[model samples]
Target: MLRTVAVPLLDPTASFELGVLCEVFGIDRTEQGVPAFDYRVCGEHPGRPVRTTSGYAVVADHGFDVLADADLIALPASTNHADHPPQLLEALRAAFDRGAWVMSVCSGAFVLGAAGLLDGRRCTTHWRLTDELAAAYPQAVVEPDVLYVEDGRVLTSAGTAAGIDAALHLVRRELGSGVAATIARRMVVPPQRDGGQRQYVETPVPRCDADTLQPVLAWAVERLHEDLGVERLAREAVLSQRTFARRFRAETGTTPHSWVTGQRVLLARRLLEDTDLSVDEVARRSGLGTAAMLRHHFAAVVGTTPVGYRRTFRQTA
Candidate 1:
């Protein structure tokens, strides 16, 4: 359903966030069996150079007119968010009113707020600026901790890599996990990261030899169908239970149990899309143990029953 995407350029663009949108939607992946979106990079004036924060300028081939036909309109971060052209704000409102998906990355949420789109809607921006966003738009319910939030057709993401997480989530929701996974594989990013995950980890990832859990975590993912309790993982990592627990939280920003549960849920999602396995079989293979348990956790994490999720995605797959 998301066939066309339009991104309007503003002055002093954050190139990394803009690049995220281009990488996710602009690339031609039809050879890989993923749908190719009609991706448009637009400026208020066609062929005008737009300044980027990285000390470079890029030109847009299209103008704001292209947005009228867009299935989605994504906003990248800019140095200036409080003030946008009246026409740009009106165009955003018109696109939203016509039921097109609208998304913002980091400080770009302020543009959406300025457009009156965030009013009475739950949204989020980067954690560093969450209070600013909330204060500027008092009616908007701003969730500071999460990577992203989806309310109706609008999506907002936190800083940097979180944009990839949020964009892949939208792809998975609209095109099925298989398509999202293909795109992620080509991009060399994890296929899924729960939007509810903390935006700020004590350490974004393990950076030292002693602190790195890469090997143990990789080992755990392959053996997710087995019991991945802290005791067992600690034994594999050669650390005592208490030390392992402390380090796991420091490295991954979540408990071992929570991380394992998330992996299992991801496995269950893949099975639902790629196989004809019954709910009970999927539960067993995903290490969920039982159908009732799968339904409970699947709904809690995925916002839908296993059966419903399969029915919706399998059609596209």
Candidate 2:
């Protein structure tokens, strides 16, 4: 259903983030069976160069007229400032009001906020700027620890490469997984990433050894059906319990419990996709201990229940 793709640029825009939108939709890749979009790079001033944040200039061939008819309107990163063009905000509000998919990359969420489109919507921006965005737009529900958040037709993504995740998610939701996978295969990127933006957020932790954990992690992965408590894992690694917990959290950017539970969820996802396993049996096989535990973890981490996931993604292979 997505046909026309329009990028609305602002002053002091980031080249790389804008480039991401162009790369995803600007090309003609029908030879690979991926549908091509009628892509337009537009700005308030047509045929004139706009200043970039990096002391560079980019010329957009189209003007604001392109956005009026777009199936998807994207806002790439710009200066994290509140001074957005008034007409740009109007265009954005109009796009959203009529049911077009509107997405923002990184600091671009500010632009959406300026447009009043993000008010009372669950949205996200770059983790670094989420607090600023929330403070500025108190009405918006800003999720600081998510890679992206979609409330209705509005999609907001985290910093840098996470735009690929948000865009591909839309493609998957609208066009099906096969098309999304085909596009990802051509792009040489993963079709999706697990976990939350918290995994990449800057935070302090005690220094820890990294070299020795590979074998331990591999061993634990193999025996996920068995108990993987910190005490048991520490005994297996021949370390004190407290030391093991700190080191594991430092290395994995998550607690031992969270990491092990995430691993079980992944294993359960594979079983759901590849085998005809019942919920209880899959939970038992994946070391989740029970179907209730599996359901809780699966829904929290993967955004779907076990049977729902299987029904959506079960493959013939």
Candidate 3:
């Protein structure tokens, strides 16, 4: 059981993002058989009416002192990008020094960076502010394209909706994929997405033009059992291999080969959790061809063998 303390700085965006953390982590969901987290919203000063950027105020009952015993500390997105409160930074440093997992959503990374927690660590924030973050903290490696970045004890997310992804990932890491998926299903979200994905996916400006690669992607998804090479996909799209490769990368921010591999791994994970399929059958069905091939790429991309991932995440029907 993890005790989470959310330190919401005074601002509209940060307060709302803190509310999201409360909804995801603080609420009791044991009826769904999901483990409940002990969560509380605290402020730098207790019982004070903290103003939000959106012309709202929230009163928090606890102060920075609540952070000492927390298993996790969350800093939500803030409106003020220039500086964070000094006392809050001190409390965050103390919590991290005590070995608590510290996380931030969007510009909340600023708070973590202020505490010197992000130094020498790979982290991310909103793309619009990536340059500022990089300029402000020369010691941190800022990855602008990623949705989130987890560096040991500290985790930082890109922006708004990506905050949910970061929070769910933390649940997946602490609990298991099964529990995380349950929560995500209840929340009507895809259970897992690679943290290195783009924060804002560029959609075609017009809906009609949005059919860019839908047909090809759908065709590829349907044929997960077959080896999907770039030539085959290009043929399906009626384009040359070079054009298809460039278009695919532009559309997905990943190569066709890498995208296919990632999709296969995802399919394999879904099978591991939801079915009683043998590893060999799963490998064949997910397009990796054989169990040995599946094990190799699964370990390379997922950091676990097929059997091990199944053992860790499988849920009995």
Maximum-lDDT candidate = 1
Candidate 3 Cα RMSD after full superposition onto the native fold (Å)? 9.0
Residue 238 lDDT (model 3): 97
Off by over 4 Å in 1: 194-317
Best by TM-score: 2
Candidate closer to the true structure by TM-score (higher is better), 2 or 3? 2
TM-score of each: 0.64, 0.66, 0.62
Q: What is the C-alpha RMSD of each candidate to the true structure, in Å?
A: 10.7, 8.6, 9.0
Summarize candidate 1's per-residue lDDT along 56-104 as a digit string, tens digits: 9999999888888789999999989677878778889999999999999
lDDT of model 3, residue 58? 83
For model 2, the run of ten residues with the poorest summed lDDT: 199-208
Q: Give me the runs in candidate 2 sitting further than 4 Å from their true place.
A: 206-317
Residue-level lDDT for 286 in candidate 3: 96
Q: How much is the lDDT of residue 33 in candidate 1?
A: 98
lDDT of each: 0.87, 0.86, 0.80
List where candidate 3 sits over 4 angstroms from the true fold. 12-15, 194-317
